[model samples]
Target: MYIGLLSYSLAAIFFLVLLGVLLTDRRQDKPSRKYLLLATSISILWAGMAAFQSGKIELLFIYQTLEVLRNLFWQQFLLLVLGRSICAEDQSPIIYRAKILLYIISALMVVLIIDRHLLQFIPVLAHYIDPLLVGYLVQAVAVLVLLEQMLRNTRKDMVWAVKFFCLGLGGIYAYDFYLYSEAMLFQHVDNMLWQSRGLINALMVPVIGVAISRHPEWSSGIFLSRRVVFHTTTLLGGGIYLLVIGFGGYYVRNFGGGWGVIAQTLFMFGAIIILALILFSETLRAKLRVLINKHFFHYKYDYRDEWLRFIYVLSSFDETIPLPTRSIQAIAQIIESPGGMLWMKRDNNIYLPVARWHMAAVYDSENADTDFIKFMEEHDWVINLDEFEWNPGVYRSRGFFSLPDWLRSMQNAWLVMPLILQDKMLGFVVLTHAKNRRHNFNWEDTDLLKIACRQAASYLAQHEAAQALSEVRRFDDFNRLSTYMVHDLKNMIAQLSLIVSNAAKHKNNPLFVDDVVSTVENSVTKMNRLLSNLKDDVRGSEDKEDIDICCLIRREVDNRKRAGNTPNIELICVDEKIISTANHDRLASVISHIIQNAQDATPVSGNITIKLHKHINHAIIEIEDTGCGMDESFISTRLFRPFETTKGKSGMGIGVFEAREFLQRLGGDIEVESEMGKGTLFRLHLPLSRVK
Candidate 1:
């Protein structure tokens, strides 16, 4: 009895100190602070009564009544705190429903008040049920639900202020629920646990004091965090699940004939596995998150979480789907929408379906409806299909022209957000109904959606830009390859020009005429190959064949003689036949370019020499000329550079560069020795084919 007295006395004193502090504050009286003052006053009275009536059976009614009143007052305080946290201009529907529930709890209190009188008149009512005990149990449950919602709905930033308050209130109501529930089953309360209640309430006094200190006026606002609601929901669901499972086990044990123990054990394991599955299901978690966000939050979205989710979805590295499809997903996920489709404006002024995610295909094209585009550009509003259907004036221009029949026919179509960037609508995304069908999207939801859709527009813009850049790079490569074909054609034309000029003189010489025929045949074959290459890209592959360098160089020298006999040409050969593995046409072209260049450089009185010899494993062909020789600077720097020549407009400049590049491809190289006003030596190193 002394311990109970000490516990309640301590609780009363603790609450008295908290109340005095709250009253001392000079801050203007607010709705939340008034509720706190009332709750604190009731707590002191309840504790004082319990302390005084610790050993008296006659005063038990007063202490129990005080307990019930104390619970009711605190529940009201918590509910009001929940209300004051809403910063929205309009009242949340949740607050209205909670008030209705509070009225129901008040009715329970009224019944408890008159239950004793009714029992006195009937006397047999006590046999079936105890109204006082059941009333306390049900009221405790209602208070617990309020506390849970208080924690879940309060903004995360404001959680610190309300956390201790919810905890303290939770402890008081939880103790009452347990006491009353046990009393209901046993038809009597345990004296020991009843005595312990005062100590538990006293312990919560300091916790409540801490909460009051954190918020002197309860000025913090409410916006639900998904994390808090998800965890709270899981805890509440798990408790109910265990209770149901316990009842089922009890029923099976009473009913089973010989298999009670075995059936009960198997059932428990199966229930545990099923619980695990439910806890891990992503779909269930998504639904739970959406439900909590829809009902508990004052605002439609938690901006920080939504922004982070947007970034994560847009920038995800899962590249199996294209960016357009991911753009649809990024927008769809913002509202917990099931699926959506994205349309982009093409150059032909048509809105083409670029991507779809889990949504059925829709209208193929839009006729570029001028009013539709103008309305989206002007307002930039997210049109809610349901609201537009119910009242067309909500979107301002729904009467101008009805939505396309294809869009109207979509049974699940819910929202249409124009993917507007820089005041120009790039396209629009149509979202299917969200996971939470009861979602009454408001100004804030549309505001966030407009921003998200604009961001998605910018992302798709970059995608389009990237695709265009890639196409340009391909065109640039083709243009570069076309330049090479033109250079080859110029060289062939120069060869044929030399033949025409010398044909009048060489027509009388049998050997000279035969050399002309051979040269013309080579040119025609090369011209055919070049034309085939232009028709179908060869990608630089050519067949290599063994060619005799002595004969090849002789033929080139003989061809050069057809240009003019004035620049006397001499052939110096150490080996009659020297074979090297190379493409015949390419090697022949290389030889012709070198000798022709030598002939062009030497004057009529000047001499040109073609020398062939075997050195080590290579066949060396040297073309030496005496005319206007190049200095070391030009030969080293600009000589082999393509399209660079002293010949001006007449020179293609790619001949020497192309020759050296082709020779290198066959495991050979070209070396030059030249001096200004003297002569130039062009040495070709051709690797000899292996001796059989």
Candidate 2:
């Protein structure tokens, strides 16, 4: 095989760049800096191999030692990277020791590959037993683990650039793993796999450049198209292989060999990872949300359907119902919070846990105590576990959790956010300590937590309003039913009065005329007044007109006399031509009803007096009677409700109700002030207009 000189040159250049990356990372934290150094060391070994492959063996034994050390550094690098990714920062010493073990293993492997006597394995250069093959395999796996961690920690609403760096670098590492594993284990390398690895390297150049330059969040939309092509090709390659296995099995049975097995394996693994990334991409999720909103009416406000459920839960005090935790957990996972609990205030004083989902059963309502309440009251903000200090008084005084018990459990809590509504403290949420992380929560995590908390609060508020609305609707229904029965009864009474009056008109020809006329007049008058008021009550308004006060007073007096009134109807008018704006039909009905009630209350011959006076902008009509007046209880409860009456024979209970309703519509009011024994005075206050 004619190994290209270009490969060696490129490898040497990358080795130098790795060294530069390591040198620049001197001031960085141990594990990250150490990993870079280890990567650099490994690059040096590969450079040695590259030089040796160019037919130079100046320090073959020394190069072998360096290769062994490089291999050992790689194991440490992988452990450190994985440990850091999982936030086991303090555990790197253990991993560093693991690297020492790998170094010894590498030395043994080197002796075996070079001498062929250690494990009966021959060292093959750029062939089946190449040391670089395993190195690439380990790197590829490390890259995949790093990518997974990056994706897990990424904020859903983060800018595209951070995501680009994460996915691009991740995708590259994954591709490199497949290519390295395939090339090293097999006799020949597939051109497709080789090209894919090259593409990954090409994609990684920009990512590494940006990451090193501290532009981790820069969007790489330019590469998105390229990635789509790469994924699509992976999918196609998988499909072709599957089709070959399913439909071309006869051809495979005759021609299948190592090449066929390798092809199928690569296609299957590549297709799965690529398709999984595409499907799980945040961009894809966002697009799905938009699609749901456009195509599905039920998911309009929230594409995830959580908002609607949150609304339903909020409007009621029914905390027994459960809510879906998927969206909340998804959000929490995105923000790197291992455990989350959402609390809502019920009835202002009591707090209830509405939702609780965690990576473990680390928190429960048992931890909710008086201290938690006080802590929420004192500091109504999001508390990040990374920044929070242990204080017994904070949660203990409020009875949230016992400090001793909490400490003994080795449970670490990182963030607590208060759910606030309109400046009133509602409740608070707590996030368990993040796993494998010591870096204080990032801004993206905080922002996302804030958003989720805000969303939960909004849902609670909406649900509460909905519950109240339902109650109001129930009250409205009750009022409607009561109103209907009263209205119908009033109409029936009116009809009975009419029938009595008709019989009275024909009484003289049949039987006792005086008794009949009196009975009919009393019934008819009572019924007529009740029905008129009922009509006003039903309409909820009155007909408006300007009426002459003197005329109305005289008419009332004459009517009383015509009805054989025992007590005289007295009239005192200050202004003869004083006119008042009123509903004439309603006012006449009100005046007649009042006079008749007054007359009934008076002794047979006791006097009833009416006075009409004009005050500034008001026509004060007063009717006084020496009748049995109302008590406090009568006036308070029974005066306004429809169908309440004092008179035994003619009281239909609609008079005052109608009178109040009519006067209200005419911009006036009727007031009654009466003692239990003294005469009653009914005063009608009407807005008066000066006569033209």
Candidate 3:
């Protein structure tokens, strides 16, 4: 088939398809769609006429008629798409006047075609003027106007959608204008240009189709389909394949001496196979998809999918995986980064590398410079190292500190995203070059990284908070155990003090010597218990057992009386055994502490009473002292607090706190009532153990 015939047939088919698409569209009522359909229909008619021109005067007239109509429709389409009005009420004066002038030109072209005498009337141009040339000039003007309108109306985001339309239509009109201007000057069209017109028109069909496919509102629901991409790639690849084969054949035919034909044939077949393999490769296809989406599409990511994956990575509770590593991995995945290192600020104002993902080159002790940290803290910028290096002046002008040599030396460092929480920079992560090298850090990338970094910072902060809390709890436990040991030591010292006081009088008594021996033995046992509690590996468990509360109280009272203190100490209790489940030594120690406190608080003339009784399911012990009584504020506020005291340097305030804690551990509690200048009452309640 002849090239001209093939080109014209393709052009006709393309326009018909466009016409059908517009007619079937649900939004044909839209002025733009309506004008587009009209323009396409007229274009089809013009191409059909031009296909059979064959130098016939009538056919030439028909072609020029359709050209005039096609130009008019194109003008209307351009105007409507550009948001210009042609209606009488809303039309601007320039547009209204231009429309009227177009109609006048169309009428004049028809008159000139009907009568050759009309050109003769313009005496100076009678021989030079041609109606076809005049019609082409009008079409060129209309196309130029359309191009200008498109340029003025298009936005950055809309450029892709309108670019093909402007290029295709503008090429057609520009060629026509050149051909007609040459014809008007030389009295004939160039044969080569005239012949190529059909092929050029056919080539423009695909470009126009792309423009329509990318129409924002018209193709809103239809994304860049996979099939469209596959076919477009195939077409482009086929063109390149043909060009390569043609070049190789020319080389073989001219340069290959005797084996030219054979070599040419082999080379052609091999090239075909190689090209086919490249087109079919999955890796190549994936790369192509990424490239097209990155360059052609407005958005680089499916935000919903990206957000869900990010959330999953951060929220994962795998104990073996550290949170800092997970945080780095989560953000790195967004940009297909191969490796990253997370740096966190320490208490000493140093940022140290704490976690790394697939990052073997980075050292654990890597620290960010104080100047760099200060700059990031103040600006909170996502530093793209490429930009920082390439355009250092831009950063320097904005008051950014110079990039550290250590950081710039890292070969793969692409971006540094600051992890800021609550207006403070916690740290930053340094990401290596993206796995997909084509992807660049843009505004969207920076925004997403900042948001993800905040979430990660929260996780890091929470992890740090938990660690600090755990340490605090450990110290609190050790301090508490130490306080109990000191209170016990205080009791032991008091016991020995009484022994020393009565040593001279009772030194010769055998019974008193036995009592002193028992007291010394008990003190040694208590010291060993205190030492055992201090060992880190040994945790003290309460030795809970049934105890005779009545005998316990009587023994404590007798020991105090033997101490020879001036205050009169008395025990009041039922003779019956009062048994309760409790730790024996802890219970004894607590009771002794209370009795000692009462003795110390009371004056020599004051009386200290100890009372024990079983009430319902509980045993109650009350110690009343007629000494310096506590005020309500002191009892409520300072009482039971470890290290707090009213007895000057002689008192270790842990006694009452330890007493209350031990009692509460055995389902018991202590209550105190006091009045200033009167006396103080202490009550201890313990759950009674059922008799077995």
Candidate 4:
């Protein structure tokens, strides 16, 4: 008996539909249509084989030849399906070799038929045809393996399509296996069962068609569309219903043994699922979308799992440890973007792509044009998706189009966000798509993109700040070096001052040995004090030591008197050996410097007094002189800084600065009470621990 005319007609219509789709899409060089061509061509051959199953000898020969050709293309078709669906790599060599072998085998098979030689592989028995037995087992196994490989080899983002494609093939294979087994074992296969298999196979064409056609061209519009949700709900609901009913029937035949109660229970469950699906179609569609978004397309989310993960990474950062390249790649993977690169502004004119994650080669165009630089200068953050026409808010937006060669490419067009710390822009992050044309970024993706950008920005800002601190530290070292050189020079000047003083005293009295000895002795004392001061200024100390206030004052005043023509000096110490807690060498140097200033300011007979007073917490030594005093403006601004002194010829300007610093190290302070043209009083407040 011929297969029912209706099955043949429906199969013919499906074949024509697939053929038309293939021809139209293939004209446009669309790769998606190849799947349709293979499925349709195999189906048409199956229909023809079914039609001519019980015909005459001559007609049987023709139909059998067609079956051989069908088998040949079936193998080729499986290779194409797996290659396209799996790695996205073209492996047409498999098909080419299969076709060549098929031609040689077919010619041999034709000669066997004519000469009555053995071709025992044929399933047609003498009594009745085995009804798809020869074709079903081989094709089913081949296609099943192909689908399995496709599911296994594809990337995670494309795995859903691979899974659906496998399931579709599996569904068809199940039906084919059932009918083929029944025909071989029971010697009869139900027409209804075979027809159901064909219809199921037809359903898969649309599914697999959608998988190949719609995939790899993802748009925000498609994901956000209501129709996509509606279709998904309908398809998934129908699939579950069929799955339940099919498995339920199978269970009744096997485990249930066709039990009435088991059948009824299974039927009820299927009906309930179907009824609920129909009743709440709109709600179910919306629910399906929510499920998909929650599970897969959550990259564009504001408060998604991706957002939380990104924030968690940002918050738990170790600034000392470097960020991994995989971290940036994870951002791109999460968002389904083509590539991403993190950029930081190193200085005014240069931006560097420090970290990169991409499937393709990343472009590193260091020097952007003046306008591009100016754009970054003007705004802390920027994003250009090649569709910069949409950004009406950007002034001089034409600069985006004027980027360097590699940057002008769509791969470099990015969504950039500036990382700011303390209202200052530190760096920018960029996400781009040039290789994979699918732009999976949505509004939710943009939100997550911002989150990724923010996380990257924070890390980059920290790194840049650390780098700045390193530079400042180097500058400080250089400044300290300059200070050391000047300190050594001051020691040499002190020694030279002594030599000049001694020489001046003995200039007219060569035989006055007494005068020479006293003068030389005073010079040696001054030199010892100056050398000690020089050592204390260069290498600092924190220890508190004993200080002789009267002795230190007398030594400093004598040095001033010997060096200059002024001579009215008196030392009035309440404690002749007043000791205090201080770095004694540093304190003595400060005392001497203060006295020299007083002596310089004193007139020809002006009084210079060094008075020491001991308080409960500190010992105060006041050096008063009738000489020029300091103004409030000069004292406040220039007192502690270098190159800030009143005396023109005698001062190196760092004396007061170094003196104040020395006193501070000893846990003490220096205070000044002065009037312009009147003598200045320098008071040293030394901590009591420095007393000896």
Candidate 5:
């Protein structure tokens, strides 16, 4: 295959692609682009004609004509650009000169072509080395002249828009000058140079495309995809980088003849050097990302990315960073703030620094009624301190005056962001200045920061809520512990009351004296254990020790017997040994409580039956009382209620509630059944321990 044909084919394809861009580009009503489109079309035709003109002497004229038209169209396009640029508003006579230049070019086309074809017999024209080739020489000089004037006359500030264009188009015309000058001097075209021209022109297409992009007047601002800009930029930069690295490695491996090891070492070190700079110098990368976001996008930040990152930072499993500090960090990253302090309102109604991220500890706090606090609550806007310092009148004046000494005195105070939760100002974060970026603060930044702060506010709120709940649980545990203590005391007092009431009657009974000693010892042991539990101050620790269920019931029955013989006690247990894992003191107190209630409910003549047996891995204790019975409604609804009791003033009504709860904690539960004018039965189910 012919090399020129292949090169021209590729050039034609490149020009066609450019033509598509022009056709599809949303032009901002620039009539100049239409000339560009025409010029591009002429390039395609010019290259295509050259590609097909293989040794065809007749088609040579058409190809040469196409070249002239392509040049003329390109020059015409430049005239239109000048009309909009340097020569715009009657600054120059480029339009009129372009008409005169076109006439001169038309005269050359006629004189050159006709002389070579029809009037070659004339010695004067023949002696002058190829009139057609001279015409081509003149066209290249004219293009160079126009390019020079365009570059020189363009305003200094507007030079960038024309520079790339001039370089691209000038390279083409300059190559033409070189090619035609050599042909005229030697009287024949250089075949190799002519073959390479198509490839050279194709390379300049990208440069021209970039030039068009630089001049925004070439297209309208219909839409610009940020993702396209970012990815395209990344790909271009990466391509350039890989090309450089590939060339460097080629040089290292091939050119280092005797120093192979040394060359390899140097190459490795070069990579390390680049890695070191990338690892240590973050300012460049940060600035680059910021620059791309600030310039290319319609918005300052990618909200979706920011939101995901914010949530991840807040909910990360890394516990070394507490919730409050993570809250500060999440907000700080949005604005590229280096450090921050989170001020949260404490229980004392004072705003204090709950956490600080990359900042010094803060000891200052503000009363809730302070003007700053009130201002933050009323007006929920992200306060830019620098903006406030510049224009104090725009902000609420009261808040500015009430700012603390530490805050006002700080050197790099940047912004104060309010963490607003459901319309309430939960807290505010103080963000410091971004490290080396002189970023222009705008409403977009504020809006994004506000949303992020609100999200962070919820996280901090949940954290605070969890803390409050935990504190409440601690107090609740203490209150329940106190209630259990009081209930235990009530049982102990009943035992003492029984002893006091029976001391006179049993004073002469030796066996009764031993029973009195045993009762006192049991009460003393319970008091000591209560003291130990109070000292420990820990609650909610279930299952302290294994209890012999059989012995426990019998003792509880005997203790209730000593309380008063109001109701005669009966014990029935088939099992000799039934072990249960439970708190010894609590289980005993609960059993005693149930028995005391049964005794109080029964008449002096009525009997209380305590029946215990193992049924399906559970030690079921049935306490039935033959006395004034309860209705089914009371047993169902109010029997085990925390504070409902028949003996209103004398009873602490949490006994049954506590009893049922304690039983459930030990893999056991209580069931109550009763009817009006009938006896009530209390059935307790305790899961029998695996141990004998």
Candidate 6:
């Protein structure tokens, strides 16, 4: 049997089988199913006639009649499937009239094909008109109607379900239209098209089979998976490969002398081996899948699964695992990267490799002054290294140099995602080449990466803040302990001063000497007590009492006068006792600290004056010294800061701080007014004791 005949015979058998199934299956007796059944039956008959009666004039008329009837049935089937009203009364007037006109044209063609003698009545019509050509034209119109219906009514979501149906039926009539139109124009059919027509029709049956299987009624039992498309594509590719091999073999066999047959056979076998190798390559398959999914699929990712997996990785929170490592792994897994390194920002415009997952070859640190860092910081770009290497112009346009040698030296670096927070470049992470290297990064990849970077940067920023806060807390605790120790030392110094004052008078007599020794021993014991209190973590306690503020000021002035070398110290106060509610020891320590500071600052000739007076409900004490005073900047910025002082090695700088804190505790405050190289005034405000 001829190849064309055999192909048509096989197609007829398939369609007949399909028709029988549709008829016998009582469930598929709906109007749409019946219309489809009728169209398929017509197609089967047409194929059979074309296969067996290619040259018979009588059968040619039958073939043409079947073509017109097939066109009409298929057109009606499409109209019904698209939910268009087939009944003339139910349709709009214009649609009804158009359908009637189409029916009239089909009927006239059928009549012309049936009665050849009718053509003799009009010589001009006979000369120009051919029944075979008229059949193709009518079929072409029917194909156009189906196309219009498909395009107009098919929704995007339903395209996959009805895709095969459109391709199958559309392919059959479209090819017929082309074949017959060419035949009419050239006066005969093209041999190649005529021979392959049966094969083309047979191929469409499988596609139509897919459409029927996907139909709502039949979809449950016969379902198409992604594997079906993959296998179909593979089969089509294999067919093309074989066709190429056949052409190559024919060329070699005809051109070569005696070795032609042998050469052709060897060439075909080698080609087959090469084609098999190419088809089975995993890398090529991955690349092809990526290309198809990127361009063909509506969604790039299965967001539900991707989101769940991403959250799982981020929330893992294993203590043994560093956060940066976990962060890099979480982002890298999204793109299926093999490994990556995380660089965190360090001081001095540097980024250091803080954590890595499976990538050991990256440098320990990189300077942020590099062009790459500058570009990423300015644009907040997620750099694709492969694209950078290939298209340096993209980066160059943005004022970037080629990929740095340091980065290129790291063999697997594929992407650099910047960790930016609040317009600051925290650092960046460099992902190694993905397991599927052929998949290029798109906007989806960049968007996901940037979001992940933000999350990671937040984690890093929080961790750094927590560390700084902890250090500040430690310093606060240390300062508190030191303040208590310093207050204890001041008490010890006061005890020593009393002993020193009586030493001269008591030195000559035994009894007085004994009393002097006892006082010295008491002072030593008190000094030991202060040291012991410091060791035991004793905090300063407030013991508030109604104390004579004038008496306290007089006693401090007298003590300073006795200890002074030449600086004149004078006290001016009213005789009426001015009492204040205060912690006696703490208030005394504060007043003493201020007086000592003034005396130390004053020259031998400078006079220090202590004046006390009552103002409303408070007692005001002014200690004025003709001393070298402080500038405004020093007084404003550092005067009360602990351990900040101009006394170099001699002063601890905590005196003003301690004094200010103590005075505030006693419901009082201190104010200073001073100028460089002139005089300093210290004013103390203390709440008066209500007992009066």
CA lDDT for candidate 1 = 0.78
Which ranking of candidates, highest TM-score first? 3, 6, 4, 5, 1, 2
Candidate 2 least-lDDT 10 residues? 215-224
Q: Write the per-residue lDDT of candidate 1 for residues 12-63, one digit (tens) a residue.
A: 9988877777777656367777777887898899899999998898887777
RMSD, every candidate, angstroms: 21.9, 22.6, 20.5, 18.0, 22.2, 22.2
Displacement of the residue 2 alpha carbon in candidate 3, Å: 4.0
Which rank order by lDDT, best down to worst? 1, 3, 5, 6, 4, 2
Runs in model 6 deviating more than 4 A are: 13-34, 54-58, 81-92, 159-164, 188-192, 208-220, 224-236, 252-269, 285-692
Q: Residues 89-207, candidate 5, lDDT per residue (tens digit)?
A: 56557577775777687567866654465555667777877777877888788778877877887789667666878888888888889999999888899899899888888877755
Report the lDDT tens digits of candidate 6 across residue range 513-606.
7776776787678667655433322234576788898888778777767875448888889546899987777777778778888888999889
- Residue 164's C-alpha lDDT in candidate 1? 80
Off by over 4 Å in 3: 52-56, 83-91, 220-225, 255-270, 292-692
Give the winner by lDDT: 1
Query: Model 3, residue 449: displacement in angstroms?
Result: 9.4
Question: How high is the CA lDDT of each candidate model?
Answer: 0.78, 0.57, 0.77, 0.59, 0.76, 0.75
TM-score of 3: 0.47
Q: Write the per-residue lDDT of candidate 3 for residues 1-692, one digit (tens) a residue.
A: 25555666677777886666656557666677777888889999988777767456566778777878888888777766665422445546666676677778777777777676777778677665776587778778787776777766677767777887888888788878887888888888887777677777777776676677677554423444655766687778789788978897889977998998889998888888888898887657756776665544446566789999998999899866667888999999988898898888865456766677787544333345566777777778888888886667656866785776668777788889899999899989999998565255666687788888988899889988986686567568868877988899999999999999999999999999999999999999998776545421222358778889998888877887887865988888853688998777778878888888888888889998888888888899989999889964466435866656787756656678788878877777788878788899999999899776
Residue 121, candidate 2: how far off, in angstroms? 17
Kindly report which residue pairs in candidate 5 clash with one another.
Answer: none
lDDT of 4 by residue, 191-275 (tens): 6786565456566655554444334432112232445645665677777877787676666656655486677576767677776
Better of 3 and 4 by TM-score: 3
